[model samples]
Target: MTMDGALARIIRSAADRAAAAEPEVCDLCAAPVAEEHPHLYDTGAAEVRCVCRPCSVLFAEDGAGEGRHLLVPRRRLRLPPVDTAVLGVPVGLVFFVPRSDGTVTAQGPSPAGAMRWEVDASAWQRLTATFPQLASMAPEVEALLVNTARGPRAHWIVPIDDCFRMVALVRREWRGLSGGGRVWPAVERFFAELTERP
Candidate 1:
């Protein structure tokens, strides 16, 4: 092939690679966003969206844009140990997701998927009264993540997306009926890193 044709082919290949490797852009304004950038939760449809800094700012407040766009906060608070027994569930890793209707749902990871466990209302009331922080959790966008795989007291108040991410990780790494060995270590590492987040 001619030198010009060969050079053009090389340029095209390089461009293709660059395009393929492009970073994820904000869904709102199409601005380039980093891997660790902010995210938005569409409450109306229960969807998570990647967003840039400015778009996040625009919808930082609750009920922004007719209550459709809710900015996901970056708060990662280490909470005191909670009693899983009181919640009517076995001692294990679980997360509490609050709905807008003033009800909270308890869910945990399993080989099949996220499994819901029945919770006692009186027990939930007692726990929430003990921790006032639980009362302030963002509705539909934040969750109380309790990691008891190691032991009790490994609780955190994290973004709602983190809950889904944890569910995904467990479902992905889980193996056979026993859950194999890798799942526990990954869970430990995840909580460790989560605790260390700024």
Candidate 2:
């Protein structure tokens, strides 16, 4: 093939790859983005947004109206001795995150967030009995995940991403009643690793 034709083909191929690798445009502003992009919190809409770097950092500046949508924090904390009653969570395996709004988001066999299976009274009681430190979780962004199998452990205040990952595990891997064998084992392994964190 001619050098000019070859170069033209290569450029087209590169353009196609770039397009495929890019993320969908922001729902609010219609901006283009690369696959991995920063998020924007829209307080007026109470929604999370995928934004270009410029827009994302612009919102991060928190000028007047911009300050309303607080950035989701990235820090993780391993807290000790959380109060269980405040959470009213009854399951040993559960997680909760307080949103900017007063209510909390929870998951698992407990009080709040999203759950794959219902938690009975006994399950709730068993969980709260073992982990009391989860009560101290800061509302919004901070979450408490209790592993009853871990046995009377302190709370680990981690970024909300960690809780979401646990939810993904259960929803994706859990099978019939008791989440079958695979999910429970995976949950245990996750807790074991988290507890070992410094």
Off by over 4 Å in 2: 1-55, 61-70, 109-113, 116-139, 149-154, 192-198
| lDDT digits (tens) for residues 41-100 of candidate 1 | 887877789998888889876557777888888888887776657777774788887777
Every candidate's lDDT: 0.81, 0.58
List model 2 lDDT by residue over 1-198, tens digit each.
Answer: 999999999999889979887557865478877776655555566445666776665555436234555444445566565555545555667666555444555566422335643234444345446655444444444566556544456456665556766776777776765567677677677666764332
Q: Candidate 1: deviation at residue 150, Å?
A: 3.3
Best-matching candidate per TM-score: 1
